[model samples]
Target: METKTKKTLLPVQGKILWDVIILSILSVLCFLLPFAHYTYHRVQWTVSGLQFITGTSVQDGEVVIASQWLLIAFIAAAVLSIVFALVFPKIKKIRLAGFLIILGGILELLFSVLFTMQVQYIMADARNAGTSYAAWLLALIAVITIARGFHILYKNKVLSPLDFMIMPGCIYFLINNYFPLVGIFIAFKRVDYSVGIMNSEWVGFSNFTYLFSSSDAWVMTRNTILYNVAFIILGNLLGIIVGIFLSEVFSKKLQKLYQTTILLPQLISIIIVAYIVFAFLSNEAGLINKGILGEGNEINFYNTKIYWPFILTFVNLWKGLGYNSIIYLSAIVSIDKSLYEAAYVDGANRWQQITRITVPLLKPSIITLVTMSIGRIFYSDFGLFYQVPMDSGALYSVTQTIDTYVYRSLLQLNNIAMASAASAYQSVVGFVVVLVANGIVRKIDNENAMF
Candidate 1:
């Protein structure tokens, strides 16, 4: 029976093997076709993928070097696919061949886009120049090859329909989230726009000096960590209180109304919040000045350093409370009601039932949120710190967290490397803080800790 099954599979495998081999060869041959066209000061130049990969010379003795690594990768993928098709010629090998084809196609597409962008950047003054027809044809061929590869894998049961369903989200994250992580290199490099990012000169830790060597370093660091500490403590405490209150409310309509009312501040734009704050605190026309304090007692709230810490803390909590409460409420809702019922039967008052049952059960949710918050302790709300303070130089001593400081530095110095370094530093510190916090939690309660 096994022999008969193998005999019957041979014809199907043979057909797929030929198809893979043919597509692989065609993808390689695409390199010989015209890849891009450029016109520099009335001179027309058309270069093939082979020429681009080898480096092409244009007007003014300028050499446009397309990334050779991409060419090498494409060739490698094509070679591996063809070898697999011819040598193994089994269902598993055929599926592997298909994956290789898809990979080669993606590489080819990236190469085409990057090559075109490089040429355009180099010859900025060039007119009537862009990717040639062959380039588009190469992309089209790549798409078809990728589709054929997926078809083979699916037909062979190597990939299920569920895999296809999740494929889009996987691709989205690969492109948007994971791919940009490569930009971390920008923190270490002296970026030159004339040459692309990969070709930039290395500066080591010099970019990092902007963050630590400055006089404001202590001020920003202190403000960032302290503000985050307050936010985590106050936000979680109030959120649990609000969540518990909402959970206990018997009227469904009243619960929803209160939920929406509390949630409205979270939905309001920070910019609008700033202006609303301005309306109350404005030195000249503010309601406090015009209505309560009268003209003679008018105070400059934006420039006053003392008022901002409380103002910012209040604003942050107001905006975050509803969202935070909703999260805790979900966990509260999921708790077994029988525990609370048993506590009440044992002569426990409402407050005792809450303390003994509700809050204890909420320990896991609180720990999870607190652990996550610790990871971002080195960061702050940019709009809340910057905009609410109205960019007051007087308030810098009180309000300059790491994020606002980075934004101000970028604006004043126009230094991309320095900005990247600041970001990288915050990320590293936050990551460490999270690990330490989680370790402490894990030591205390192994089950509640988030790994």
Candidate 2:
């Protein structure tokens, strides 16, 4: 007997919403249509023959670069958005359209700046390239409308709603985090505030040379990486142990008390913690010297460099242990009880159950936490290294970190450009390190990887 085969049908994909279509059409129109024209206005005479959209103008009978690149960027972005809307129509594709539109807006801004800067050069026979307020308005509208369309897709459930909630935060980061990237220009320039930021002389990497040429480079770099490595390894190990122990406690009241006691340190301000450390380690009035070691045998703990590595490590673990363990404890609590019951049925002891089942189950969490920690391996806790050690010059060998070094240099030199250069270096290295770490995690176990 021949059996008839059943044909399986895939779920139909949702169509791109009307809002996205309307905004995309508008964006394309803004790019293609004659939205604005460049003109020259000096004193009383006026010249208005430059067309921005077509990138053409008869200025002083000579062909000039009339914002051609800016127009190309806008047209390219608009074409890309239309292609995505029609061909793919996925939420991710719509989001990409929004990103392209933002880029186009940025290009419009650059065009205005460049044209303003070249207004004098374009002056031949009293004709100069001038910016049009309409171009800026059209670019602004395109960006806002595209972003609104992306939001509408999320609201209609064509995209995840969670993304819509974080839109405000994304905007904040774009403004705060990414907008500061313009300062990188200051890093490369010999910033003379006397002649505004844009008019500053370009020095071409001279600012960065001082950082490498510094005598304390190796010491600071070594201390930062080594201390962070120790913290990451020890922090994860102790956090896991404490978390497991906390989870195993039978009384809920006792668990709460233990959790509260450990967590209190995390809430305390670092400055207060610094003072508290000072109170304990002060030579004349220290609790350690007068109360424990006796007044005659007092040690100037602030000036002592040798003991700070161990001291800082201990303090870091103590302050952060409770907070870090809470994450592990949450994962532990969510685990299935039946597995433990089955382990008990097989006559497995508590230690055996932990070793065999609990630890194995916690692997993903541990891996995830460890991967994140490694990303910050190039960074050091500034307060722990600086304030906790009292920033004593004697302790520089042991306590100096990238942040502290930058802070110290900034204070002593008061050179904004140099400080900016250091910051740019740190940001670049940190970014590369994070990417490398995430890549490594993805290679090992794709399931537990952050990306």
Candidate 3:
């Protein structure tokens, strides 16, 4: 017989020292590497009416300016935090280090912004100068180091083996989700590529105008919110119903068959699903038109917008119900069977048992799922709105949503600033809505609410 050993949690050795070493290396690199380039140029232009035509000009060699020293201050702060972490084992001292790291990160940001402004004012052509990749790496490293200090301060000791297991995922989230948040600045910038992202003039909410100023804004916003609300309500309702029904069936063979059949649709790609929909809905050479409805009174499903609301709702349910139901099914399966047995002994019928026992038990899972869904209410699946309709102009009024609108506008205008602004707006609004929903849930039923 093979024996299985239990794993134990232990603090990682030299974890703090490793972090300090990495921080020290990056800090030194900040001073040694070229922070940003300073370009000098002479411009000669010929006037034609109010327009000026540029002529060829020689570029002066790039200069490494003195502003790089600002990073030295940041490096000093990081080193101080690391030293404190090593020398002082007290909680207050470690916390002080965390505060210092945060202050250093903030100062770094202000310094970089001030440097960009100085570059813009000094030489007109110098505005085109770009910061080196090293500078960006330094900023990212500073933030990570700050976060590390805080984590250490929280635990007041080395991280355990269990913490190490989750470290990779935490780092990935920081890089993929949190780091890209720096690009939110693009939403406020005019974004002249000739002048780099940092050097671009701040337009202050001008990019947001593109989204709300259009005549179709109201229609798109309304459709997006309404469809999401319907999806949340209907999806949860049907999922719960099917899950409960499945749990009631005692046969193993029939239950597996039903589960597999329902889940198969979720595994299929949306593009393939669109083609299947096209086969049934297409006016010309369609299964419905030629085979079922026959020749005379064929419906053009693609062109007509009225039928789409129903079609889309049905399609969403068909594709999503299987996956959504699995959550409720798992919860239901874990419920104590003794409760149902006791209810039966009390002469409770199936409907009464479900109402009194099953529904009440499922409350926590339902509230959690709904709260998460609310966070993404402003977002829509792009392929559903764009590809499923076959890009029909007539159907756009009903099918158009925030995701599709941003995609189309991105292609048409090729303005990244506008797209960034739209995305930032969606994220902010969704965050606020989720917070409000969670707050209401907490007040109504504190035990079932998600914190």
Candidate 4:
């Protein structure tokens, strides 16, 4: 049989009508469900739909999904659920059909269930007690009605409710995240607590001068930037190599074991990870001293500045490689096996298949990882440098990055100004690096540039 050509789905305005309806229902359900819904005698998932939506037991906060929550997740689910309903009817539970449709319907229902669960999770996010469900619902309804009113007045469907996705996201990002970025200039200000934020006098590069004036500035900054560069390079390379090797391995069980093993460090917490590292490197009680070498002498890891760069890079990779590999693995899996068959027909060996087919296809993911990484090169992993070293001054030469330096200062001086200034410095450096890197990527491969 000939290969099936795929058709791409395009977004349309009319597609969002279903979303409006579903969202309206979700909003109303959220508003009334808690009062109408019930829970088991003991707190459990068997609670009423409203309870599932409102249940509080800090997912991020004692936060009920809706109970004491005030129903923010309910409104969110209602709104987004409507959008999914309108645009992707094929995936909608009420509209599913066909032989594979049974599985598809189960998956869609699972998706919806999981999606609502996630809304509850985000509502409990460390961000707040929960967002205001009433305010959000009112805003959503107002926005939808206004859009429809505008559509009727213009007598042209120039857009639809789905338009809010891109528009609202852009606007909120600009207002909340990007707008605050302008404060980077404050890094150069002589910010005194008494002077207030904006009232603080502008020092015009004085803050930067003060930073550079420190003797440890160059060393710390250099170490931070260099370590990040090394992480971005080595982390992605190792991740891709491991991902590709796993993809090529014949035994599915072994591949899964390796994947899980590489991924474990990423899943574990940094604090726990520091303790784990200490178990091996501790001077007296460490495995290296007692178990491995059969010696009881302490290694005095605190003073070992020379070993830290390598140690930091290794830890960074160990923590990140599995997570990053998923991207490469996805790219590899997406490649048409026909390409591999063609390579094999040309007498290409397994090595040749990888070099010729796998690496080339994975370039997009690699570039993306590198570019995103370059954007954060000035920022160091706070956990790795600070907690891992136990904050020993002896290792400061290698471990004291801009982040840890700022933290150390924060603790010693209680100086928020300096901390903000250091953060601003990292942002400026990181932003400039991202812009330059994007420009270079654009020159080399226009499609890959983030812009």
- TM-score for each of the candidates: 0.84, 0.72, 0.75, 0.62
Candidate 1 local lDDT, residue 99: 76
Q: What is the lDDT of candidate 2?
A: 0.70
lDDT of 3 by residue, 322-391 (tens): 9988889999999999999999999999999999999999999999999999988999978788888988
Highest TM-score scorer? 1
Each model's C-alpha lDDT?
0.81, 0.70, 0.73, 0.65
Off by over 4 Å in 1: 1-27, 40-44, 60-62, 66-112, 134-173, 193-199
Q: Write the per-residue lDDT of candidate 2 for residues 246-283, one digit (tens) a residue.
A: 99999999999999998999999888999998899988
Q: Any idea what lDDT model 1 has?
A: 0.81
For lDDT, the strongest prediction is 1
**Alpha-carbon deviation at 222 in model 2, angstroms:** 0.8
**Candidate 3 local lDDT, residue 396:** 88
Where model 4 places Cα greater than 4 Å from the true spot, the runs are 1-176
lDDT of 1 by residue, 1-451 (tens): 9899788778877777777678767777877887667777777877776776666676555455555665666677677776767675544455666676577667656655555565456455546657777667766777787787788779879999999999999889978876667579899998886776778899899888756888777898899999999999999999999999999899999999999999999999999999999998998789988999997888889778888889999999999999999999999999998888887789999999889888998998999999999988998999999888888999999999889877876788777787788878888888899899999999999998897
Alpha-carbon RMSD of each model: 3.8, 7.6, 9.2, 14.2
Candidate 4 per-residue C-alpha lDDT over 1-451 given as tens digits, one digit per residue, 9 for 90 to 100? 1232112222322334443464356446544422221123443222233444545543323434322333444355455545554545454222221212222222333333433443444443343333334434444454453444344323334445675457678668756886566456566666666635555777787766777898767987898988988888888888888888778878889888888888888999999989998998887788887887676555666677777788778888889989988778878989999999988899999998998788888888889888998888898889999998888878888888999978876788776567767777777778899999999999999998889
Ranking by lDDT: 1, 3, 2, 4
Better of 2 and 3 by lDDT: 3
TM-score: model 2 vs. ground truth: 0.72
